[model samples]
Target: MIEARRLHILRAVADHGTVTSAAAALYLTPSAVSQQLSALEQETGHRLVERSARGVRLTPAGEILLSHTHVVLAQLERAEAELAAYSSGASGTVTVTSFATGIGLVVAPALAVLADTAAGIRVRVRDAEGDASLPMVLDRQTDIAVAVEYRGAPGADDPRLTRVPLYAEPFDAVLPLAHPLAAAPRVPLSDLSGDTWIGPFPGNPCHDVVVLACEHAGFQPTLEHLSDDFRAVVALASAGVGVALVPRSALRGMDLTDVVVRPVDGIAPTRRVFAAVRCGAEEHPLIRPVLDALGKVAG
Candidate 1:
């Protein structure tokens, strides 16, 4: 019989498209991954992969096995979830991943509540961005991921995962105290058409949001400064270098001495944050309580 663990390794390899990448995802060495793949081939009596200079390609046999692998793994996940539900108490560790601001706004508070109420459940947290967090959950790297609605994120009805809506937060304009619009009750995105913008790097989800927001307002921002850290973005605005738009949660516990924040007047740019878990494991006893805690905190 083929081992379930070997099938898992194969699925990882197939998903990642390289032995090295699969090994990194599984926290194993490439040599270990190769050995497991070899063992799996021997057990199945089929040449599963064709290795080439570029990368390994799945053979017909490998493709056939991969189809079965998904079903087997999902069934196993369902079995584990059911078993956990029937267990006397929720006493296992639940790993979670979230972006920086969500960590402060949601995960941290949820963790605090879990510690006080569900003492038996141990929680491990990893800081990952929205783009990476949901994939981490799909890869079984984390039990839950706090993610945001970003360009290229998986849809809400993605079959492999279950998404739970958390919060919808608007991005506020940050400007220097000395700026002309600093005292305005609200700032329009078009008003900053000529202002030098400080924003996240181009590929970042937040950067995409800012760009889309600006496009909707009929102008493209002249991004003079790039930063992933929202606090630093606000600080740059305060220094009179450039203006920025930052999420509300990012300002928590920050000192905004010379920076003024105001909502956008017409089209408010907002991000929706949510939680994702493996589709079949959402009802796991330990996971359910953590989800509850997160919902309470978000509420």
Candidate 2:
């Protein structure tokens, strides 16, 4: 069988245009390179190189073999490089799952940074809402997941997840521009008492927070609209549909032309942003970099 080392010698000779230069590049003696080339010729039953006083050149068969060798060697080099990067936590495909707003505001930018900084890393992101993203990490279906929860919300105790704090985005009042309370420097929960409320879709942590905030402020929230998407809620608020309580991060990209965001006067409802991976796989090569990226974006 033809050895790759012998092939290497032939390839090197062709690359350097001479056996002496090939030997110099390999840090091997010219005699050693000559022996390998001779052995390769015997193995292939063809003349691979013609040596002259000046140097050497490939014959017709040698040129064809060299063309094929170029592809094979390049592939092998790439495989080695990819394996090294995978081992070093520098590169690999990272499967990430995140909620809608988080993807647009946070994960997408972080991934863009990762693409620019880290080579051979391919990120595949799935847009899964809230706790739904947790299962992707827990089931090992994703390398990392960004999930959100209000302080007292259920399902924060997943033993299979190794959670990292990303951020705690404070909730703010989103009011229509024409509303009396919209001009306030800080809108109190009491200010929204009679206003129709735009709440998150039922069962979402943000939805519960909005309702509980209203009730704590001495009134039962009159939910005039329900939207899981913060942007949609903002759009509705801008259109005078209703006021909403939303996390600041979720509102970052929304155009508030007909709407205004103000700090809630009394109680500040915040949603905890967490980066989670499968518990035991905390040592995963691709996990830390993504987590680091998320942390950077959060900050």
Candidate 3:
């Protein structure tokens, strides 16, 4: 029977155009290279190489064997990589970029839960606002990206990405302890005309949504502060810096001592959260668990 080792040596000889060159390249003595090729030829019952003026040339059979060897080597490498990834807690690390609320309220919590459950899973998180996260994900800087968009604000341009709608949460106007609106179960848009507003600054999805919602509410807001940090936004809302528009998911189980979230009246402001991955790698073994974990946490 022909051995894979012998086949590999023959392929090297075919590639290098001479047994001496192949032997040197493989760190094998010329004699060993010749012996392996000789054994391979004998096992196959065929003449695989012919002497040339300079060195040697592969016969038709040798050419075919060389081609098969490449296929076999590639298959073997893929198998090894797959097994290693599976054994090492899906060993490849997933670098994730997340929107503020998603990081604090969703991804961070899920990763903590996964650490306790999945031994082979590893995660790296980055604070990426919605606008920058998409390009980072498409450029492969981040393995997964969590972002926010209005129902149709993602635009019509579809790049090479796999988008999953994780969840959508209603937007609420957050009030401070002394605000008169704090006593109302939910504030209507008509009541927001004269109030100061807290918003994520420029280029933030929440900021954009806050702008659009206010326009729909018959008045543009007087922006008091622009904050991308959800913790800071919460602190501002708690300090009565200004009333902020917040996603329900951000407050779902969080404790806000001085802040109250009331549904905005007349306009049901909602932000759609999405998770994106590289198109081809969306099915990678490490990706499914993380996506499933998001679903679990979002639920």
TM-score leader? 1
Predictions in order: lDDT: 0.89, 0.76, 0.76
TM-scores of all predicted structures: 0.85, 0.64, 0.62
lDDT of 2 at 253: 59
Model 1 over residues 13-131: C-alpha lDDT tens digits?
88778999889988999999999999999999999998887778899999999888867877787889888777755897999999988988889999899989899999999998888
Model 2: how far is 212 from its true place, Å?
Answer: 3.2
Model 3 agreement with the true structure over 141-258: per-residue lDDT tens digits:
6878888884333442443456777888788888888888898987986677788877778777888787888888789899878777666777888998788888777676666898
Candidate 3 C-alpha RMSD relative to the actual structure: 15.5
Best-first order by TM-score:
1, 2, 3
Best by lDDT: 1
lDDT of 2 by residue, 1-299 (tens): 87867766786687568888778767789999988888888889999888789899999989888777745654554465456556785666888898877887789999878877665678899987665666455334577888877534335464335678887877899988898987789988977788898988776767767777788888987898987877788999989988889988777756877888999997687777788875545445465677778888888
TM-score of 3: 0.62
Model 2 poorest ten-residue lDDT run: 151-160
RMSD per candidate (Å) reads 2.8, 20.0, 15.5
